[model samples]
Target: MTYKQEQLSEEKVFKDPVHRYVHVRDRVIWDLIATPEFQRLRRIKQLGTTNLTFHGAEHSRFNHSLGVYEIVRRIISVFEDRPHWNKEERLLCLCAALLHDLGHGPFSHSFEKVFKLDHEIFTQKIITGDTEINRVLEKVEKGFSQKVADVIAKTYQDKLVVSLISSQIDADRMDYLIRDAYFTGVSYGHFDMERIMRVMRPMEDQVVIKSTGMHAVEDYIMSRYQMYWQVYFHPVTRSAEVILSKILHRAKDLFEADDFTFKLEPTHFLSFFRGDVRLEEYLKLDESIVYYYFQAWQDEDDVILKDLCERFMNRRLFKYVEFNPNLQMKDWMELYTLFQQADINPEYYLVVDSSSDLPYDFYRPGEEEERLPIHLLMPDRSLKELSRHSDIVEAISGKKRTDHKLYFPKDRIEALTDQSLKKKIITILYGQGEVEDVR
Candidate 1:
């Protein structure tokens, strides 16, 4: 048998908390997992700064990637005998599921936001670039690496294959929802995944759910909504993320400043600060490396850098209050000016973080971010969009919810000797009794 057709003599199983067990029998998958690029995920936290809020939420991307692969494995097994499900695409789907999150950097979202990087682009690069992952994929077949990349990029010729990984109810989402919930000790993400998987039917261009499983799909959607508010977007997690982003911003600014000299050279971050990070450099800077820098920068000469690093390392997260940009523009301007007068850099200390979510939405062409609506296969060989038939889903469908919070160092403001300035800031911030000390 060719390398592409090779299978393990015995299946390798990973005992997983969320999926029970992840079984691997394909040689290509086993080899790919052994690659350094894949192993690097072990050091990268799945939830980033969320560990500070939920101590149990310390799982890694490695855990999530395997969970996704297992889910897709079970899904493809069901699809193998169904119409419109290509057996040739089985390994391709599994590969994409396992490696989908390959390019996530340390503190993934915050690093991407502060550095203007996209993990999806990096994922494609890792699969196609000069790397072990690319090498293993190339061994699968000529041009196979590009095929996997295309699947992840949502540009593959087979829309059915793409939907298995990228669609609204894909394996990636299913694994993360349950996996994250399991680790974080939250009940909001619980749902009947097995029911959803059993009811999944392959179609010409996407996967569909049988009418009998509509309630299961609804439960999954609602679970996702609750998980977003209860665990994923918890205010305490956001506070830590705010501080992390600020730290990256401060470090980058210091790196750009001619007069600023780091007592210890930021070797790992130099490429990131310069905006020319190569793949090798990107993979080397995992969460442990980032934490090392944060620890060292605590002793730096720059006060802002030192302070931000200290806050992050010690979890002295900034307090936050509900903020409405439209109604509080005057107060915001005044507060910005007062913070500057008090020698507190408004840029680093005062921040507004906004988070928004669209729990579920029907397909709308040409929209900025179009979400492909979930479809349920009817009893009479018909199809209907999920929200169209379910009143529970219809009520919440297409509704976008947004939250805005103003984060600032309340302790710093309270420490100011200027009594009048302190009172003004306090009255503006705490007047509504919205001050949240996410300690």
Candidate 2:
């Protein structure tokens, strides 16, 4: 039995702040988005804790999926008559780009950290499992769903298809860098995307930028760097994550001791706490359901649960300062002991935040996860690795930057009943004086 491709009478469009309008021409793509599993993405925030820092970033992955599909569609439109560009690969690329993040769970990073679940696994399930997305893919062909999954999994033998969605400069990154920047209301996303698209040429196995468009590529690389530092790695976001991780830890502890009762459903959380989670149960969990529990736990008998929930809900983010992991180990221990003495839980109050990213890594022999380095098409029709041709990419290539921040609740510290313990903790956290930014 074969499913017929059904199109809406009038083309359906989603009004997006980033892409303006995402057009759905194919019935399969439209049906995939309408599925309950896909619709759940609308409830999950794209930037998670970033909403507390940038109020405008209240968008969701559903918006991003559409944006990615549009970008890939535009790319495919440009390469329709070009050599080495297969028209048959069009739908596969579009579907892969649109569903690249389909597996992302609620509060993605925090949920992953607590449950030890990888979103990529869920993404494959959504595409191949007994879901509407699978039904839609099967409409294209019997094994079309697996092909789509392969593209996202980066195991598709067609390097061209894989490069379109998973490469360093693929539609996924191209869309998110711009979408995230636009929603966060930052200027760093102002790269010449039109120019980049214009210069993109499909090769035998990959997409290469025209040498004439080298500057645009450089601008893109720099924009990504700035966005990472300015938005993606913001200390405030990490602070919120730290608080959330501790909340999950405390909740698990309480559940184990039977020391607390949940007023709402923690169905998804129970399996995670017990180290066993089924895929179907995992699918039922979303950010809204998790947040509902947080709201209800606000009035719980456990003081720790109540405080953490209040902190997360009210945007009372933890205060952060530069930290030296080795040098501060002693100070950290002392601070923990001091918190115990002051009746404050050091386990929740003290946290170390760290983030690292490789701006532009060039291909090297025998490296784990060898990146397919970006290439520039020379006028002579030869390809050159971007780092070899661009001084800027060369300078930043293989260079990884890391930031460490010590996070604590400054508000509670200032109100400490034990003056001596407070003084010690203050000295350890902020170095021997009244903390300046104690909010």
Candidate 2 off by > 4 Å: 1-10, 432-439
User: Which candidate number would show the highest lDDT if scored against the true structure?
Assistant: 1
TM-score of 2: 0.95
Q: Which ten residues in a row have the lowest lDDT in candidate 1?
A: 430-439
How close is every model to the real structure, measured as TM-score?
A: 0.99, 0.95
Error of model 2, residue 293, in angstroms: 0.4
Estimate, for each residue in 1-439, the C-alpha lDDT of model 1 and write its tens digit: 9998999999999998888889999999999999999999999999999999999999999999999999999999888788999899999999999999999999999899999999999999999999999999999999999999999999999999999899889999999999889889889999999999999999999999999999999999999999999888888899999999999998989889999899999999999999999998998989999999999999999999999999999999999999988788888888999899889999999998989998999999999877888999999979999999999999999999998889999889989999998988888888746698777
Tens digits of per-residue lDDT, candidate 2, 1-439, equal: 2234456679988887767788887777887788888888898888988888788999898888888999898889889899999988988888898888999989998889876888888899888988888888887888999999988888898999999998878888888899999989999876988789889999988999999999999999999999999998888878888888888888888888855677664666888889787767777888888888888889888898899999999988788778878677887788888878877888888787789888788887798788889999999998999999999999999999988888888888889877877777777766733333523
Residue 261 of model 1 has an lDDT of: 90
> Residue 60 CA error for candidate 2 (Å)?
0.6
lDDT of each: 0.93, 0.85
